[model samples]
Target: MVTDTDGYIHLVQYLTEHLGIFENSQQQATAEDTVMELFEAQLAAQILLVCGQNPSLTFAQRNLIIREVDSIVYDLEEIFASVSTDKATPEQTMFITEFSGLIKNLFDQEIAKLHLA
Candidate 1:
């Protein structure tokens, strides 16, 4: 069986390749709301994978995951605020908003599952 970290790396690689968020040309652009959204989503996935698999982890470890997720959310909010009106295309903005929501849902689901077990 694959370890949680290995699974996360595979998932991140798959998401990066299929989502085209940070592809060759895409990386040249300055960081944007969409880029931050993708980054937060990846972080959330990592947290979910870790917590979901290691329910027996120490309290400190769980707190660390929560702290990391909170930091990502804060950074994402900063990115959203800094986007210029002209650069914040409607489609891109919408995608980021939806993606962030999906990431949050995944986190909630995983946490709930842990509690229920």
Candidate 2:
């Protein structure tokens, strides 16, 4: 699992950076949605991986974690939605997507370990 929280902070920073000027609001909205979706997926995967790693966790504990993750992500979405995307660098956007995938792969590795063990 991705134990470091820096990835999450960087995601927020990259997303807050202004994006390319869109031809229309629809285009901008789509770009924002894509970025947010990838971010949310990464967050969920990391949290789930951590919860899964602890085999001793009770059902209620697992459920609590899931619910907390969902709540936190929802709050972040609201915050990110308000950030203006007037001029984002391509590198920042690319990094967000790529980093998200990398974290997810880490989570996947943890799952594979569970099965193999």
Candidate 3:
């Protein structure tokens, strides 16, 4: 299964491929917002997948996971704010590499905890 990190990478790649479509700040802003929304949705679905795998997870635990996802999404938007729509940069690649690992490590830790419980 593709992780949210992978999904996000693909989405960014797709956006970068057609970056010319965003001719103005308004269009770029709208596209960025849409991307963030999609990432948030993907995070939620990932949470659901995790919960499904760990049926014994309590309601509170699930809620905590949801909150974590929300926090991560917020952080990601902030991190991605500097990304240029007109052209790709080294910073964009660095941001993706850094955050994708963080995202994966976070969920891996969470899943490990669930398994250990």
Best by TM-score: 3
Q: Compared with the true structure, what per-residue lDDT tens digits does model 1 show for residues 1-117?
A: 111334334543544454433234333444454555554655566667667877776797588568756864664555444432223334444455555454555555555565677
What value of lDDT does candidate 2 attain over all alpha carbons?
Answer: 0.53
- Give per-model TM-scores: 0.39, 0.46, 0.49
Each model's lDDT: 0.52, 0.53, 0.53
Worst 10 residues of 2 by lDDT: 19-28
In model 1, the worst 10-residue window by lDDT is 1-10
Model 2 compared with the native: what TM-score? 0.46
Q: Tell me how many clashing residue pairs each candidate has.
A: 0, 4, 0
RMSD of each: 8.6, 7.1, 9.1
User: How high a TM-score does candidate 1 get?
Assistant: 0.39
Comparing 1 with 2 on lDDT, the higher-scoring candidate is 2
lDDT of 3: 0.53
For model 2, the stretches where C-alpha displacement exceeds 4 angstroms are 1-33, 82-117
